[model samples]
Each structure stands twice: as structure tokens, then as C-alpha cells.
Target chain A: DAGITQSPRYKITETGRQVTLMCHQTWSHSYMFWYRQDLGHGLRLIYYSAAADITDKGEVSDGYVVSRSKTENFPLTLESATRSQTSVYFCASTITRYTGELFFGEGSRLTVL
Target chain B: AQTVTQSQPEMSVQEAETVTLSCTYDTSESDYYLFWYKQPPSRQMILVIRQEAYKQQNATENRFSVNFQKAAKSFSLKISDSQLGDAAMYFCACMNYGGSQGNLIFGKGTKLSVKP
Candidate 1:
């Protein structure tokens, strides 16, 4: 239980509603990421944070927003959820981007109707 | 742009047999790394194996091994003596160490099934 953990393992929301997926890691990793897993697209990075107060967009980041006010936590928010945004979200953390593999949380699945 | 491609969407194999999953990538960075991750039904992402581009030798871990062909821009995962637990979605990913942020480009997964 010392590794990364996600909140609301499963969620259901309506379109135009707001949803936030929470991610926290005990490792205090400098780098954290949010990725969405779809059927044909595999896993696409939504957003990433290099450190506290520093976040950047990824390949599919238009509908997602993230903030890393703390090194251990990175929460992704969908301001206006859509049907296409329904997917499994994974939170990952790593000590350094140069080496080592990322540690992922047990994913959070979201459904929008 | 960097990209990873997994041609096979699904594959089946007999228990105790061997199966290979193919992956190809396009990247401009000479020094990078490739990884194979297994996503079981539990939906946890587990690292299977990793290979560095500069290293000529492939990487292996127990029953899992990778055939990394840097020249051909191909990396394949081979699972020997497959078991029932090996049935899951396998993904191939690439990361450029020299690039910015070390963001990983992942390929579409291959769902592997082990038939008894």
C-alpha cells in the first residue's frame, strides 16, 4: 500500500458534469503523469508534472486539466465531461525520467453518459 | 513525432507454449529505451521487460524476453511456457531519454489468450 493509489476506482457521471480523478504516490517522485486508456488508442498521456507547480500537456490533453501543487499528488479534472472522455485513467510516478520504469496505480475507470 | 505500433490486436496460444508479440517504433532519438508492459484483468500495469537502444544485447526476465532490433526499429516480446496468468493485454512503449520530459509513446495493446 506504500505505492501509488487512486481514488474513486470506478465512477459514473453525466455529460457537462465535472469529474476529478485523484492520484497520490508515497515515493515523493518528482515526475507524475496522467494517461487515458482507450480501446484502439492504447494509453495516451493526458498531462504530466515535472515537479510541484510545473505541469505540461501531452498528446491528448485538450479536454483534461491537471495540477501538481504537491509532489506526491497530481489530480486530473475534466471541467466538462463528455462521452468520449469515458475511459480508464492511470496515474504514474517516477523518480527520474532518464531511467527506471514508471510505477502505476491500479487504474480508475470513468463512464460518462 | 514518436510513435509505437503493435500490429496484432489479439493473439492466442496454448498453455506451456511460446508466443511472440510484435512492436515497431519511430523515433529520432538515438539513445532511448523500449518497454513491454502487461495489463492483467486486474487492470494493473506491470513492467515486463526493458531494452536500451544503445545496448546490442536483448533483455530477458525469467520466462519473458525481448528481441530488440535497433536497426530495424522493431522490438518483440517472447513469452515461453505461457501460463493461464499470462492472458492479458500486452503493450509496447518507447521513451527517449534525451528528449524532453521522458514521455512514453505506447502502442495499441495485443490481447493474449492462453488456451488450456
Candidate 2:
């Protein structure tokens, strides 16, 4: 795809299981982000990477882990998925951090039991 | 910490009419950014419009325009000649440069319905 793409558009896993959501962007943007969308909370940033190997935590990064080994790839992993982790995950990228314009993926809906 | 609030949880408007979605934010940073994003049924987030806090002029893009009030910390989106395709969940977000530049604080969102 020419734009950002997310893998496993729909996923279902049990509690205590490990799950990974992959994000790939063709734009090679410097900024990549992971956000979770819930009912009342529009979308909360889980993690963001300024560049490869440079990552930072967001508001809700307690149970999430992110790694950016390559500029085009940023994956989010939940070592031990819990019921509270059930939500739609979105991956976004932007060329510049100043403008705040983001291009998001189609989103991966994960359901944890 | 910055917070974005969209007071209208749900709004309905007739096709070809105009509708305004209200958003308010609280931020300590003097210079920041405000944005409106649209999420359709496909769950893809699309940027509708953006406004810089330092700019006094409101931003207008086609049928979409934003009224940015820095003093009151209000950023409202007005969609003119609303169409059926405009029906979606609209989210307002804020990003401060003093903090993580790319990190955005999003509001609860307003689900807009267009009646044809």
C-alpha cells in the first residue's frame, strides 16, 4: 500500500496471552504513534517514536510496549493482554511534529477475554 | 497536562444544512495546535482541519471551517452544506509544542448524523 497499513485488522485473544499489532508506513515519516480508541475516551496515545530507536511513552502506556527497529515499521506489543486492553488500536504517522497533522491506519480491533 | 473536551456527544442535522461541533481545550502552553479529525464507519481517522494557536485568523477548508478562540480556549468546527457522507464521529485534539510535539490530546468526540 502507498499509505500506512495495519496488520490483523481484527484480532481476538484471551487474557494472559501476548498479542502484537504491526504498523507500516510507506511515507517514511519521522513521527509514528500508537493510540487506543475506547468508548468515552476518543483516542489516547499509547506510544510514539520520533525516529528509529527513539521512542517515548504517552498518557496510557502502562501495559503497552513499542519498538521501532526500522523507520517504516512500528509495532505495539501487549505482553499480557487483559480485558481492559480490548479496544481499537490505531497507528498514525506524520512528516513533522510541529504541524500536528497525522495520517492514520484503518485501525485494528482487538478483543480480549 | 492538556485536555480536550467535546461537549456535544451526538448531533443530528438535515442534509444541505449547516452544523457546528463544539470543542474546548485546557492547556498551559502558550503556543499549541488544534485539530479536528473525522472517523467514519471504516474506522480511519482523517484530518478535517487544523488551526495554530498563534494565528488569529480562523482556518477554512472548503465546506469546513473552525472558529478558534484562544482566550476562551474554544475550537469549534462548522460544516456547511452537510452531506450524508459527513455523518461520522468527529474528534477534537490538541498538541502542545512545549511537551511531546507529536503527542495529541483528544476529546471524547461527537457522533454526527446527517438526515437525508
Candidate 3:
């Protein structure tokens, strides 16, 4: 794809199982982010990476883990998936840290069983 | 911490008419940004329009426009000549430069429905 893409658009996993959502961007942007969308909360940032090997935590980064080994890849891992973790996950990228406009992927719908 | 709030959970507009989605935010910092995002049935977040806090002029893009009131912390989106394609979940988000840069705090969102 020419733009950002998320793998496993639809995922279902059991409780206590480990699952990872993948994000890849072709724009070679400097910043990448992961956000979870729920009914009442809208979209909350989980984790973000400023550049390769540089990452930071957002508002809801308690149970989530993220890494940016490469500029084009930023993956979010749920060590122990729970029912509450079932939500639509979106990966976004921007050229600048603060002022740049964001570009989001289609989103990965994860269902916890 | 900055917080964005979209009071309206849903809004409906007749085709060819105009509709406005309201959004309010709370922040201590003076410098920041406001944005409106659209997520259709496909679940893809698309940037509708953006308004900078420092700019006094409202931002307009085609049929979309924003009324940014910095003093009241209100940023409302107005869509003119509404069409069926405009039906989607519209989200209001705020990014604070005082803290993290790329991190965005979003409101609950308003689902806009266009009736033909």
C-alpha cells in the first residue's frame, strides 16, 4: 500500500492471551501513534514513537506496550488481553511532532473472547 | 491535562441543508491546536479541518468550516450543503504543545446523520 496499513484488520483472541497489532507507514513520517477507540471514550492515545527507537507513553498506556525498531513500523502489544481491551485500534502518523496533520489507517477491530 | 468535549452525541441534517457540531475543550496552556476528524462506516479517521489557537480567523475547507472561540474554549464544525456522504462520526481533538506534541486528546464524538 502507498499509505499506512494495519495488519489483521479483524482479530479475536482469548483472555490472558498475548496479541499484537501491527502498523506500517510508507510516508516515512517522524511520528507514529496508537489509539484505541471505544464507545464513550472516543479515541485515547495508547503509545507513540517520535522516531526509530524513541517512544513515549500517552494517556492510556498502562497495559499496552509499543516499540519502533524501524521508522516504518510501530506495533502495539497486549501482553494479557482482557475483555475491556476489545476496541478499534487505529495507527496514525505525522511529519511533525505537534503541528503536523495526522493521517490514520483504516483501523484494526480487536475482539476479546 | 487538556480535555475535549463534544456535548452532542448525534446530529441530523437534511440533504442540502447545514448542520453544526459543537465541541468544547478545557486547557491550561495558551498554545495548542484543535482539529475535527471524520470516521465513516469504514472506520477510517479522516482529518476534516484544523484551527490554530493563535489564528483569529476561522478555517474553512470547501463545504466544511470551523468556528473557533479561544476564550470560551469552543470549537464547532459547520457543514454546508450536506450530502449523504457527510454522515459519519465526527470527533473533536486537542493537542497541547505545552506538553507532548503529537499526542491528541479527543472528545466523545458526534455521529452526524444526513437525511435525503
Candidate 4:
């Protein structure tokens, strides 16, 4: 495909368990981002990567870890999942780090119990 | 920190009619970017339109257009000849300039319903 894709569209995990959300983009964008969407909060950024091996924390980065080993893949990991983490996660990518449009994935709905 | 505000939590418009969704933002920077994104039940964030702060003219794309009032810091989206397909959650986002990296700050979003 020519767009961004997220794996495991629906995931259910137990509290304290580790879960990883995978994000892949075919455009090879330099900037990749992870955001969690919830009711009343809209979307909050968790993490973003400028390029391979360069990543930074966003507005809501606690409990979530992200790594970008390659330009096409940026994965987010939850070391110890909590019930509060249950929400729809979105992955986005842009061709430029300055001024560019963002292409989003279908999203991953993670339910923690 | 820059913040985006979408005042209308929900709105409804009849098919083939025009509807405008309001958005306001707070930022001290003179140069920046604004955007309107649509998310349907499929949960895909699609860019509907974008506007540059420095530009005086509004940006339009097909049936979608924006009313950008830089002095008031307001950016409203106007959808002409609304269709059922336009029903979705619309979010307004802001991005500041002069930063080494670009990250969007989004509003709570407004849910638009197109009635037949």
C-alpha cells in the first residue's frame, strides 16, 4: 500500500502486561507521530520521531515508549499497560519536519482491563 | 504554549445546505499554520483544509473553505452543499513556526451531522 498502516486494529491487554503498537509508512516520511484519542480529549500526542534514531516526547508521553530504528517504521510500546491507557491510538507521518501535511493510519483500539 | 479551541461541540446541517464550524486559537507567534481535519466513524484523520497565517486570502478545496481572521485568531470551516458523507468529527489544529520540529496542537473537535 502507499499509505500509513497500523497493526492489530483491535487489541485487548491485561493491566501490567506489555503491548506494542506498530506503525509503518510507505512514503518514507521524515516525521512520524503517535497520538491517543479519547472522548472529551480529542487527540493528544504521545511521541514523535524526526528521523531514524531521533525521537522526542510529546504532550502525553508518560508510560508510553517509542523508537524509530528506520524511517518507515515507528513503534510505540507500553511497558506496563494500565486501564487508563485504554483508548484509540493513531499513527501519523509527514514528508517534511517543518511545514507538511500529515497522513494518518486507520488507528488501533487498545482496551486494557 | 499554543492552544486550539473549537467552541461548537456539535452541529447539524441539512443536505445541500451550507454549514460553518467555528474554531479559535491562542498563540503569541505571528507565523504559524492552521488546519482542519475530519475523522469519520472509520477513525481516519483526513486533512480537509489548511491556511497560512501570513496569507490574507482564505484557503479552499473543492466544497471545503476556510474563513481565516488573523486578528481575531479565528479559523472557521465552511462546507457548501453538505452531504451525508460530511458527517464526522472535525478538529482544528495549530502549529507554531520557528521550531526545529513541527507538532500540531488540536482542539476538542466539533461533531458535524448532515441531515437528509
Candidate 5:
């Protein structure tokens, strides 16, 4: 109840439909990151936010849009989901950018049909 | 850019036995941090153990210990008295402290199976 949580633990969407994964953390960590895990590739960072209104691209950010309006919430949206985008998305939070351990959520499993 | 590599894609250990998972990294910076994370079927990334590069001593947490060779740039995890709960994917990660921001660069991961 007091940790990072991702909504819609399991989701199925059409290839062209829009989908958004919500991530919320109660720790109020300054750094929030979104990563996609797939076979062979492992975990690849999609986007990261240093603080409110401050976000940066990661290894794979294409087709993914992230916004951090509030420190507790960081949402990742896919404008048009694709079959290639089907993977497990994880949300993590860190108290500081200098040195801190990351706390991950349960993960959101997305299946694009 | 720092790169972490886990040579063994999968490994199996009998219950109550010991097993070691190998991890190697390439980095120019001397000061950094290394971590081992376990992702079970639940998909929650849990920090198993961590080692600071500056510390010459290895880091250990109960049944989990790291054999960190600074010179070789190798960090392998040894799990003793393995249990069925130990069955999961373990990932080795590296974080460079010399950089402006310390972001973790993770390896592909090694899946460990605990056999009865």
C-alpha cells in the first residue's frame, strides 16, 4: 500500500489503439524510470524523469510518450500500439539521482493483438 | 558507455547445493557500484546484494554473496544452499559514479533453476 504500484497489471489492446500505463509511487522519489523488458533484449529504459516536468529519453523511447506532472505519478502512453511493443513494462523510483537504490513495481504486461 | 554481460543464459542448481552465476562488465571509470537483482515470476525486481567498487571486500547478504574482482572487471554471484524460492532470473547491473547521473546499466540476466 505504500510502495510503487502500476495499474492495469494485465492489458490487451489492438495494434492501432492507444494505451497508457500508470505508475504511482508513495515514496515521492525524485527519479522515476520506465523500462520495457523483452526476450533477448532484457530490460531497456524507455524514459526517465529527474523531477517534475523534467524528463529524458532512454535507450528505447520511440513510440512511447511519458509525462511527470506530479512527482508521485509518471504515466507512459503509447500513441499507437504495435505488435513489437508488446512486452512487460516496469516502473521504478529512486530517492535521488546521485546515489540511491531503485524500487520497482509489479510490472504491467501488455499484449498487442 | 558501460556494458554489463552475463555469460550464462541459464543455470540450474540442486536444492541445498551451491551455484555461481558469472557477470562481467566493461568500464573505464574506477569508481562505481554493482548490483544483483532477482526477478521472480511475480516480476518484481528485488535487490539481492550490492557492492561498492571502492570497497575491496565482497558484499554478502545471507545466502547470497558476490565475488567482485576489480582488476578483472568481473562480478559473479554465489548462492549457497539454494532453495526452490531461488528459482528466478538474476541480473547484474553497473552504475558509474563518475558520471553526472548514476544510471544502472543492466546485463541480459541469468535464469537460475533450483532442482529438487
Candidate 6:
């Protein structure tokens, strides 16, 4: 498909276990972002990648790690997942830096027990 | 720092009626971008409408429109003739064009419920 796609639409993991959420886009956008959607917190950016190897932290990036080895894939990893990490994760991409509406994928819901 | 605030956590309107969702933000920059995104039960983030800070005219799309008050830092969405399909979590987001790469700072969403 031409749009972004997320893997494992639903997931359940145990605390202290490692889990990775995958995001891939067909547009080859230079900017890719990972955000977590909680009940009251809305969507908080976890990590963002400017290019293939350049990544930056967002407001709530404490418990997450991200890597962008290629332009199409930006994967978020939890070194040691916690119950608080149980939320919906979304991946978005945009072609322009300061302009353009973001294209998002169907979110991945992760529940940490 | 730029922060978006949605004062209404939830709102309900009967079908065929109209409703408005209020959003306020704080920022120092004069020019930026504002957006309203919809998240449905399917959980896909959809861009409902957008407004540019420099534009004097409000942005509207079909039944969705934004009453953007730049001086007051207010951006509200008004859904006319609301329908069941409009039931979703609507988020107000802001992105500063000052050295940022389209990273949206979103407010706590306002859940819209359309009742029969």
C-alpha cells in the first residue's frame, strides 16, 4: 500500500519484557514520528526521526527507544516494558518539515500486564 | 513552550444538531499551524481540518469548520448537522514552524458522542 502501516494491531505483553512496535511508510518521507495515545494524555510524541540515522526524543520518550536504519521503517522498542506503557501507539510521517498534514497508520494497541 | 488545551473532556449532541468543541493554546510565536484530528473507534488518526495562523479566514470542510481566534489563542471546531459518523475523539494540535519538523503538540482529546 502507499500509506503507512503498523504491525500487530493488538498486543499483550508482560512487565519487564521487551516489545517492539513496527511502523513502515511507502511515501519514503524524511520525517517519521512515534506517539503514544493514553486516556487523558492524548497523543504524546515518543521519538522522531529526521532522516535515516537521525532521531530525536519527544516529551514522553523516557521508556522508549527508536531506530531508523532505513527511510521506510521506524521501529520503537521498549527495553523493559511497564504497566504504564499499556496504551495505543501511533506512527506518523510527513514530507515537509514545517508544513504538511501528517499521515498516520492504524494504531497498535499494546497492553503490558 | 507551546501547549494545546481542550477544556471539554467530553461532549454529546443529538443527531442532526450542532456542537462546538473548544480548544485554547499558549505560544509565543506569531505564526504556526493548527489542526483538528479525529480518532475513531477504528483508531486511525484522521485530519479533520487545518488553519494557518497567518490566514485571516477560518478553515472549513463540509460539515466541519474552525472558528480560529488568533489573538485569543483559541481554535474551536463547529460541526454542523452532526451525524453518527462524527462521533470520535477530536484532538487540537499545534506545530510551531520555528525549527520544528511538523511535530504536533496535541491537547487532551474531546470525545464527541452523537446520540439518536
Which residue pairs does candidate 3 place in steric collision?
Answer: none
TM-score of chain B of 5: 0.97
Tens digit per residue, CA lDDT, model 5, A11-90: 99999999999999999898999999998777888999988999999889999999999999999999999999999999
Off by over 4 Å in 3: none
**Per-model TM-score of chain B:** 0.98, 0.97, 0.97, 0.97, 0.97, 0.97
Please give me the DockQ of candidate 2 compared with the native complex.
0.77
Q: After superposition, how far is residue B79 of candidate 5 from its true place, in Å?
A: 0.5
Q: Give the alpha-carbon lDDT of every model.
A: 0.94, 0.95, 0.92, 0.93, 0.92, 0.93
lDDT for position A107 in model 3: 95
lDDT of residue B20 for candidate 3: 96
lDDT (C-alpha) at residue A77 in model 2? 99
Residue ranges of candidate 1 with Cα displaced over 4 Å:
none
Comparing 2 and 4 on lDDT, the stronger one: 2
Chain A accuracy of model 2 expressed as TM-score: 0.98
User: Residue A81 lDDT in model 4?
Assistant: 100
Q: Per-residue lDDT tens digits of candidate 5, residues B1-116?
A: 88999999999999999999999999999788999999999999999999989999999999999999999999999999999999999999988874544458889999999999
TM-score of chain A of each: 0.97, 0.98, 0.96, 0.97, 0.97, 0.97
User: What DockQ, between 0 and 1, does each candidate earn?
Assistant: 0.75, 0.77, 0.71, 0.68, 0.61, 0.75
lDDT of 4 by residue, B1-116 (tens): 88999989999999999999999999989999999999999999999999989999999999999999999999999999999999999999998865556778899999999999
A89: Cα error in model 1, Å: 0.6
What TM value does chain B of candidate 3 have? 0.97
Better of 1 and 4 by DockQ: 1
Error of 2 at B74 (Å): 0.5
Tell me the tens digit of each residue's lDDT in model 6 across A7-109. Answer: 9899999999999999999998999999999998999999998899999999899989999999999999999999999999999999877774889999999
RMSD of each: 0.8, 0.9, 1.1, 0.9, 1.1, 1.0
lDDT of 1 at A74: 98
Q: What TM-score quantifies how close candidate 3 is to the native fold?
A: 0.97
* Share of true Cα-Cα contacts across chains kept by each model: 0.63, 0.78, 0.72, 0.54, 0.48, 0.72
Stretches off by above 4 angstroms in model 5 are none
